[model samples]
Target: MEIFMETPTAANGGNPGKKKRSWKKLLLWLFLLILLFSLVFHFTSSLLFRKTEAGHLKFITPTVAQFRHEIAVRGDISSSENQDIKCRVRSTGGVMITWVVDEGTEVKEGDTIAVLDNSTLIDSLDAQQIKVAQSEAEVKAAENNLLTAKIAKEEYENGSYKVNLQKLVSAQIKAKEERDRLAEYLQHSKILYEKGFVTQSQLEADIFSLKQAELTLRAAELDIYVLKEYTHNKQTNNYESDIKTADANLSSKKSVHLQNETKLKDIQQQIEYCTVKSPSDGKVLYVNETNRFGSSEFLVCQGAMVRERQTFLRLPNSNKLQVTADIHEGKISYVKVGQSVQVHTDATGDKIIQGTVIKVDENPQPTNHWMGNVKEYRVTIRLENPEGVLPGMTAETKILVEESQDEKLMIPTHSVFEHGGKYYCIEKKPDGTLTPITVELGHSNDKMVIVTSGGLTEKTQLVAAAFENRELISLPELAAGETSSPTIRPKNEEISGDFNGENSNSSSPQAGMKPDGEMGSDGPKFGAGEMGQNTGMPGEIPAGMNGMRPGGPRPGGLRPGGMRPGGPRPEMDKMEQNGEMSAGMGENGFPPGMDGMTPDGPKPGMGMRPGRPRP
Candidate 1:
């Protein structure tokens, strides 16, 4: 019975083996469906959700604006030449406020702005004035003293002193003579006393007389010495005193004069400071005075005490407006004087004002580390029509530093890439493929570049910008030993032989020829017959043909004919012979020694056997 059950063929739904097989099939189908969906999603994403590595999607647009040109506009205003105002003193006691006139007030030259409190100055000046007066008086006194001293010296030398000196000298001589006489008398008295020629009393009396005489002479000599000493002391003291007095007086006078002059200058400066005037004819924009210990503008005030040299208000010249824009250092090389500029004020909408580049900064401004990694140069632009512009206005300026005109063949700068110092363009072929075409480039502004040569024409289509994350198709690989269908020929290249033949059939010779004939041999025939041929008849003269016979024709000689074996050989013969001619042969065998044939040379017709010359 178990065998017959034959595994009862496990009830279709209840058999675990059969059920497991079905479940496995279901799972496989689900996996396949999921895989298909995933593949579709990946393809769609690649096509739709494409972006550059920097998370940007790029696309190509027609470069309609091949060239950018601009014009600069600027405001007109006047500047003050007298920018600096000077005063005697700059800083003194605790930030003094010396208002001349109000900041924006108008005044003429020499007008005052403000005045310092000159109370102290005035008092000092008065004191100096008094001192000057006193010094003047002292100087006069000194002059009088000098005069008195001179008179005293002259009087002493010529009158009193001279007389006294003479008297003293005379007394000295008299005293000397008296002393000699006394000495002789004493010698004789001594002799008389020793010989006892008289009594003792008489000898003593004689000695006394000699002694008295000697004492008198000594007294006169002592008086002379005392008088001389007195006179010398007086003269020296008087001269020294006079010199001292004069020096003091002169010094005092000079000091007083200098002080007075300095005081006058101070007074004048104070008066000048009292009046205020406008430095320039500009409208005052701001007058702020909020001392908050910040920047300069914040520290200014209106009613607050404003010191000298402190900026109290700002007056911007709205008439003459200019924009100071910073250009990147990398692109500064293209900036030059006279370039056109388009300035976009932030306040204004998309409307742009025109301007011209007035100046380019020669040096770069200082940079701070906090700023992004970039270097910039300051460029000044003068607006061409600055109607409603103001100072300190922020603007974005686009400078057109270069330009090209009139339907020039231009290509994308990046499409014409360079490698190994050679420029190339990825030219599109008729088979929806690309070919690497070497190109010669010319002047380029910033984006589109000019193609000067290398078989590039206006109809030639090139890949400008490429899709991101897409592989580049190499021309050599795509060609695979097959030539590209579309051939790019430059505008100046000649048409193919097939096209030329077709053109020739459709056009007549006269129509195809230019007014001056085609270039090269197709040009107008200059000489007779074909080029490089000698086409002369039997003595038939050729017109404008040199080294040929002048007669109309000869019996059996060369002549000009409609057709000859070779073209005219004038040029060849002239070149070979180096321009030399026969000495004596003419149209009629005329001799070289003719009337008109001078020593120098013969004139053309004068030396010829006249027969209408050549044709």
Candidate 2:
């Protein structure tokens, strides 16, 4: 840049005074030019470097506005009272879904929403039937045994006992008759002997005969008493024990029968559970299909095995509308329960929904690992007149965290800058020079910021942008004290599918059933209702034989009750200690690191040796 100056030649040659005046005038113009050049150069350098401010700076005056401080968040609409349809059937290995209602279908209460393949359950039921029959047979056998025992006891007590008593009575009668006959014979012999014709030897012989008969009768009487006291009592005791044993067996069989019946009933109930129905009337929301690790699978469909109690569907109560939004960690503190909010969504075509913040979750939502450790709180908003909204519609919300009612001086959002914990504005002075003015800031919006302090007025012209020689110290200062994340605008649900992508989000059973043949790698590894390692012969129990539990009652054999317990061995203390080192062990100790062996047996609990306790 060059300056134009007319020569003072005429005045210079005329007089010394005039020349001096002319030179003074020239020096004054030169000083002014130098100052202007300096200012221009500074601004030029700033422009070249694309620094804070340059010659292109514009100025504006502050205006008064209603200042409302709000935090903006994005989230989805959902039913406040969602009724989840969960998988109710329980199995050690899961159950395969046969058919399910199409996602997002409207249905009434008690609608048959889904059906599961119950072939396995039916097979189990058949096995249960067999078990019940076997148990019943065992119960019947035990009952028969008990009845036989009772009958035997009765017969022995009455018929056999009476017969034995009658036989004994007959023997006693015979013995008595013999004794009487012998006595009579003896009397006759005595009378004969007493007479002259009778002999004394004969009478003596008759008396001895009579004594023998009496002793024989006494023996018979003793036998009867012994039979009644010992044999009959012993028989009765035996019958009682037999009956007790039979009764116990019957009770055990009855318990088994009850268990079998219960198992049958359970299988029946599970079969019923196979047919899933919606409990309430609403639109059906299929749960997101997930893998075993709980990661969402794009391929969830029929034949997917849902675990017990896994959510399959959601019946949203659309009449009661609410939204769940994710508020960033930095701004979550501004949100609290019972604050007013404004919601916007594309579905409503910019129609704003009035609402209130019903909940500000203290805990953070599960975030993608790539999102760093930053927590995003789940803020709940209850909307007024949200009649047509549905679940999964993304909502743009602004929570009114703070407000200042009085008219406050505000300016465009870009005009303010901060430095060293202070806000500043470049005020254009009347003298045509700009200087920095410190200002206290308050509420702000997307387009304007409120100025609370500093001597700024309504008519003061402030630099619209920071210029050369005036740069903010921090990144936050340049953005008018707002921390905004870089984003793509008008985010919709389709674009947010990858949200929380870095985090594995497993879906519920019914969320993403795509078609008949689709499934995850870990979901229903079996295809087309084919079971893995569970296919078995009909009427055969799936897990065990004769309804015996698997993995116990026998471990060495593949089937239950197929193996016996291992035999006993000598107690550790009773084992004889070998003097020599064990086979494959060095001569020192059994472990080949010995200090105790001296051509003698190993000490107790020492290094292991043959016939010795392990060290």
- List candidate 1 stretches off by more than 4 Å: 1-63, 69-82, 86-88, 92-95, 98-106, 113-211, 222-294, 297-331, 340-358, 366-376, 380-399, 406-615
Worst 10 residues of 1 by lDDT: 478-487
Clashes of each: 43, 9
Error of 2 at 597 (Å): 59
TM-score of each: 0.40, 0.62
Model 1 has how many clashing residue pairs?
A: 43
